[model samples]
Target: MNKKDHSLLTRSFKNISVLFFIVVLLLLFVVILINVLFGIYTWDRLYMDLINALVGVMIPLVLFNFLYDRFTQQHKDRELSEKITETMLLDEQVIDRFSNDSKKAFIQKSTESILGKTVGNMVYDTLIQSYLSKSYQYRHHFKYYISYLGDKVTKTFAVDDETIFIFNPDDYYFVREDLSFERDITNFIQSNDVRIGFSYKESTLDGLYQRAEFMFRENLWVNEEHNSMLQELSNHEMEQFVKSFLQFTIEIDGEVVPYQVIHNEGYEGFHLLLDIPETLHSSVLSKVHIRFQMPQLRTQKKFIVMISEPTEDVEIMFMHLENEMEVEAIPFLNEAESITRLPNDTIKIDIHDWILPRAGVVFVWNDRQ
Candidate 1:
């Protein structure tokens, strides 16, 4: 039984014993008064007889109550042990029979045979506390199972991510971001500063080659000056200019890997095919470095880094290379580990620990003076 039940039982026994003793005292007092009124014995002799009677009644009552309580406790303990044993047997699908009571008697007995009983009980209690907790419900079993499998299949942890923003001498900003992470069947998507985009669903035939597509919207100039600078360029020249501003490279285990980029039919963006080695599918680490430039016409800008998978450490730095600017960094769904401002006009934000998906940092900046 639990502690609350045991305590209630003990309290009830104590109350009953007290009530019985009180009734016995009242009966003995009445008998003594009747004898005195009838003049059968002197007051002192009556008092002595009353004392003897009281002693005889009280001793047997106390002894019988003690024995009864001991037997009752023993019975309850046996019942509790039997219940636990039956539960364990049912959990293991053991045949319910007297002869098989000792067969597969849970982890407690199995562990006790190897370790001592004390250590075995400790292990058993720990497991019971964890798996058989009161908070656990049978209805949530599927939910818990799905969560376990999701963590296993989609497990990707980032080792390090560093993004640096440098203010250029011209009316453009330079950004270089480097990221290292463990990959599984992960899809990496990259896009420019476009309002709308689309991606092709990954497809594989006969488990050999995979095909996918990435789309980007046509460039939307923020100001007339920005539009005039690239208005005279042909389609090919515009594509080259855009490509020059946005460059992407990837490496696996410190070796450069080749990838194909093909222009999609009737689309503004291109299709990419990555020839990832089968041997380094999920076991090896990969790094991606991207360099891009943003025009100054977009005065108020927000640079957001969204975490799509588990990550360990992330750092973002903003360096004032040319002009002064006002910058503020904010973390979503979590607090940053540290934000430091260096002596060389650099603001760095660091986050350490396992950051879940959809939790990320946002850097907002605007021109000053």
Candidate 2:
């Protein structure tokens, strides 16, 4: 072989080796960067780092993806808010009965998966509810469906032994928020004893994995137990029923959310402290809804609900003994100090002047139910 041909071959080999080495270095850098971004979560200064990174050049790719998604989601959410109703529809096949062990297992498994295996039981199970909540949100970057359709539109089903799917319209509001609203979810979880699990519908988009899981959560559902008594009026057998406390059945959102509200004393008239589901727009502290048979009182005709702390908006509603019975609540003054008379027809307490916590009179009118 000629000297020139040998020299050309040697140079080609060196160039090829250098190019391979460069490619390997670039690939290794990419892998390390991804691991650093995803795997390295610290207890300290992590949030500030994210906030600073959200700007132009330094923004993390995962953060950018989530931010872009949530930004575009605002439009969809606006449409959703108008279409969706505020209340939840309870499904007939909803699974309410769970063995104690089953309940514990659900809670344990749920917390562990979202909060990571190393998180302490006390942290996820008990205190720092908000922390666990953020962890739950961080578990994925996707969305799901909720049951409630809209206001003035409610439909119940009667299924045989099938799973009853109780869902809130607000569930979609929180769940689809992506990573932008992780702070809010975190705060909510910390305050609320929220243990959440999922139900799969077995469908997906990107791959074979299930996608559209119908979301549900736990809530305190009201039930009516008749406490009938004797009423003697001019040889009349008219029934006079004195109302008892509103019986609250702890429905854990079709066994998806395992939070059991432990009754602990709060302020003057606040007995509940743990939580309502994350789906609802209002906080647990603000909501004041009382349902009774509308006591057939012989003496008192009117009742006044007062607000001690003075809430900006409060709902005062009433439901009749008859299932078909519906009521329309009269709007009260806008000021928080102003009081409103309780009407028999009111069904929802979406807005209120204020529920005077000091007086804390939760009962309705004495004469007219």
Candidate 3:
């Protein structure tokens, strides 16, 4: 037998020896008790005759046997108790080892499951259905983290940041494979109560696989963004201005980035600047295009068109000006108005000026040129 088997046999033998000794000792005690009871039953007649002659001899022998048996039994019990304790200790160690190994196996399995093809497909598909399905509507607020899907797209927006955009797929645009995008959308239902939900769509899949993939990751529809928008817009006095629509354009090195517009809303006369994904940010600033909506207001002719980076540092060249005034209203005409340089490159163009009460200004950003 192997060394391990031999050791196991030896341990078993020791336990068996302890048990045998305990049994033998217990049997001797039962025999002694039976003999004492029998002797007591005949004590008057038998012991009376034999007591005088054998009592002295019998007493010493009986005492010696009793003492010897008691010590032997105690020794056997101690050995058995020690062996039992040792076996228990060994069993506990084995149990602990098994528990730890099982836990490790479970952790490995769980990790594989989360990243597995089936689970990924399921998550992606659910997200898509939540948006495209007629059961729910997504409005102004949208959110998502792109890196979780290996750097897809990430964007966060308030309700007031809404802009509308249109796209023409046949135009010159950069396309890359293996890109996936996810978003949580909020919109109002016909009942006036705002409904919130999650949806995800990816760019890689060909044809209908695209729609099938996003339906699997749908989760509970919650109204957290609605409350946030209500509080912010009400506090800012911009509540009446309600979000119109939103659009996104991805640009890389002055080239258009091709992305399917899953949804859009509120795209009339307001100028909008939708944040393009940073992967395309550098390309945008290299040669950027500001897609702005023209104002339908009557006073729009009085105000000149000027675009400046929100952080006014260096004066970027002005794009368009109204001809109604004898003089041009140039933004960089006053150098002091320039504040600080943007840490990162960005493109800002003033499509139309903010008007007073005569013409309320609403800027909408759209992706469509």
TM-score of each: 0.40, 0.20, 0.18
- Report the backbone clash tally of model 1: 0
Off by over 4 Å in 3: 1-14, 17-369
- Highest-scoring model, TM-score: 1
For candidate 2, give the lDDT of residue 275: 49
Those runs of model 2 whose alpha carbons end farther than 4 Å from true positions after fitting are 1-188, 192-315, 319-369
- TM match of model 2 to true structure: 0.20
Candidate 1 lDDT over residue span 317-366, tens digit each: 65553254566767674654577877666666666655655465666677
Winning candidate number (lDDT): 1
RMSD of each: 18.1, 27.6, 22.1
Give candidate 1 misplaced runs (Cα > 4 Å): 1-171, 185-245, 262-272, 282-284, 287-297
**Candidate 2 lDDT tens digits, 1-369:** 899999999999999999999999999778667766887654355656657667654557768889999988998898775443221113323223556455455566656767787785555565445333433222111111111112232212123433222223222111110100001233444455332211111111112111112011222121111111111111111111111111222232222222232221221111222344556433322222221211221122222333322233443333332222222223333434333334543233443333322232233332223
Worst 10 residues of 2 by lDDT: 173-182
Deviation in Å, model 2, residue 102 alpha carbon:
51
